[model samples]
Target: MSFEFIEVADMSTEADYEPKNIFLTGGAGFIGSHAAILLAKKYPHYNVVVYDKLDYCACIENLNEVMDLPNFKFVKGDICSSDLVTYVFKENKIDTVLHFAAQTHVDNSFGNSFAFTQSNIYGTHVLLECAKNCPTMRRFVHVSTDEVYGEGEDFDAKPMDEEHVLEPTNPYAATKAGAEFLVKSYHRSFKLPVIITRGNNVYGPHQFPEKLIPKFANQILRGLPVTIHGDGSNTRNFLFVEDVARAFDCILHKGEVGKIYNIGGCNELPNIEVAKSLIKILGKEKEMDDYITYVPDRKFNDLRYTITSEKLHKLGWKEEMSWEDGLRKTVEWYKTYTNRYGNIENALVAHPRMTGTSPTNI
Candidate 1:
């Protein structure tokens, strides 16, 4: 399909005109997929080009809902390729870029930091370079994680704010932190219009089975044991995927250039409790306790990590879904996916729980 350039003001002449032609990296992944759909619905007049590498975690099935949308376009490419990224910006006439492409699994990051560094750090540099050269680009939104602030077990009583110093404990977070630095540097040195957002743990539909929540949900649905690392006391603030997507939309539309915003859900729960809650939702309460099996902890499992979305809230964006309702919907979606796809294990190679430093692990 040919790329179409859209003028934001054409959507609604009465509303303030926002620039269009959004270029989204990793738009096929779980959160990115939802973001693309939401963007299409909100701005039907604007064109959305999705650039994805189709990595292990990314699935085209996530885009089924928006496939027929005339404004949506999909491009198969890697963000780390400077030439490819540059070509995309020029060909699509992209005015805004939402960078969500990265190796995000912490366990996988520990096994092979190389991919994380290449994709998260160098890829970000490549995107920044493209944006620097693209005269039409107005906003470059860099999506990051709260893990950059490091182990927050000590601060469990309070939420971490944007000013918190980065003390990443894993390769994944380290590389993400590096990417954030690169974006900020580009904004300062080259005067690139960039905004950074760091959000807390996100869980929702279309998540790959490797992630904790989905993995456990899949196991429970299959009548398998849900593995809990080190008694599952680790706590985290969970944000719904849609809420995270909305946060990105808010940043793209209203965020100030060169600013960093923290997006998080006020909902916090321990890992064990979350698993138990899922069990209850599945109506397998009798097997709930039995389904949870304590496993060895990862090399450096952060006890807790939380973020305060005060800045994002001030921007007139707030999380609307309750944890209870979101969890119910998430569980139901996984059930449906499982029914259609059969066992998740059969669909993809299951990565072993991080146990040792074997080269092939994760």
Candidate 2:
């Protein structure tokens, strides 16, 4: 199926809105980098401008492959800066916006709630304000997380749907939920064309080594034990990064405006189980005792997160890579990169104290 948006004067239908200049936020990060590359290559006619603040966990190396693409360009700026956001939006005549910038780590949010609020909530509002005034803007794709639903009892009974109430357990999720409300409000109050996507945990190459899959994989490669919060039973649905980009592309082209869609991966596993599986994948089963460490639980750890993507699936979007396959690919990439580079410190966007513990929005 074609995921290209059609150009029109009225912009009444999805096919009528063809974006020539795409403003992509957070393109230096993992998922953003992937999406930017796909859009630049797939839609060569569109100018893809990547605007990012290069936060602690954002690595410029992630975009190394597509940096030279004729259609691709990068701008170093913060989304919270109205002046910068406004300048880029007006200067580029950005008609399409894929917002993926935010302070995403739940753990860090506890100590740095202000940062999350500033970046995720305030930053999103800045974008909305700028986009609302942009005459050429057609689509605003706001990427959110499934964690907004929290781990309430209802989650155990059923996967979260689009209508699920926002019950974020941590500061990071709360900020994201707040951002969603802002985006929705803009659509309602200003008639801004926007689509929101809440995706499950995303794992693949180019991910900062702070998340579960990459964190454990890197630790294993360094001959260090993988640290697990609490008993490691907290579960989450893991989706491949490529599938996430596909979902974004589909939503950008086919998703109804002012609506929300859940992008889910069917693969779900407990944290401990995930650790064991990774040990096996790395052929470190014999060193399991030495390679796995159970730590104190997070102050406010959610038991699990589940979401249904029936809405997105109906739009011809489904995960192409299984969890095992994706995990293997991720492991192989980290192993080779580590062997060649010697330390992940080189790829880090900031000091280890920050990037290593910072929770990513994915």
Candidate 3:
């Protein structure tokens, strides 16, 4: 299960990086979609090829702003398909690959662990296999999660750095860590010019309702109960998707190869506080108790995931969106724009683990 480690290849730095065409797996999902839009519009010369399976969390409408762009192309395909992934790289003459496709929900991973392993590990392997064969490839940016560092429950503890030990607590985080190992192997063995990013909890528009902010925002907007796991003491550093998009752009253009970067948000808030913020935004603070519900926690829920992003900051990337602005923008979008899942009731559940349901096709 290992690729042979070999000498590093002649690669390009920030100024030397000449991206002919860019490839993004899961380019229609939350963070992926935002990145697609930013990359496509910002670099109109670089052909942006979006290869997405259009999973439950993805919607073609998410890329509506860039749909008509001449440089933006969308292909409905899975990263696990070696043939398709290979064909895309060869046909597009792709030099940059941003791997974002994965089963990324922790709650669902409890019951649907295999899907996580398959998408997060094996699927990533398939993409790496194809990426290694491309002579034109200069960058393979693997978008990972800070959860792979596992629990940093102590809010006051020193934030984990890029070299921090990988200690995943749940099935989802374990699979993500496994995928990171594969990405690193490719960089070491084949000199694939790889960069890995461990980003914190990302929120903003285009996010699926299954996640914390969107789920609670949806519930509060609908006058439904905002379900909180346990006593809602679990804290997460929330980053705006736009900021994350900027971070990816900076990394793609200037990040050092063979290095790992942490994309973190300055704001860290407990689950209860976040829920309350959304409630207040919806003008329902008076009925906060009625609009909120307590649910049993997962078998293992980490209180916090602390990671430093000084490395990314050195690349001239910083989070610009404040918590209040980001949360307000997210809630406002979900309130008016409806019709992604049709009956998003399943997504708004306490712990959505719906398997085999057909995802959208872009």
Q: What is the lDDT of residue 207 in candidate 2?
A: 81
Better of 2 and 3 by lDDT: 3
Ranking by lDDT: 3, 2, 1
Candidate 1 lDDT tens digits, 181-256: 8887787677787778898888999787777788888888888878887878998888899998898887777777
Write candidate 2's Cα lDDT for 120-209 as tens digits. 888899999999999988889999999998884534478878888889988989999999888888877788888889989999887878
Alpha-carbon TM-score of each model against the true structure: 0.90, 0.91, 0.95
Per-residue lDDT over 1-362 for candidate 3, one digit per residue giving the tens place of the 0 to 100 score? 32333434465434546577999888888999999999999989989999988777888889999999999999999877899888989999999999888888888789988888888888989999998898888789999999999898676799998878889999989988999999988887777888889999999888888889988988887879899999999999999999999999999888777888999989999999999999999999899889878999988999899999999998899899999998888888888775665678898888788664222211
Which candidate, 1 or 3, has the higher TM-score? 3
| Regions more than 4 Å wrong, model 2 | 1-12, 15-17, 152-156, 339-362
List lDDT for all candidates, in order. 0.80, 0.81, 0.86
The local lDDT score (0 to 100) that residue 289 gets in candidate 2 is 89
Number of clashing residue pairs, candidate 2: 1
Cα deviation of 104 in candidate 2 (Å)? 0.7
Estimate candidate 1's RMSD in Å: 6.6
User: Model 2: how large is the Cα RMSD against the reference?
Assistant: 4.8
Candidate 3, clashing residue pairs? none
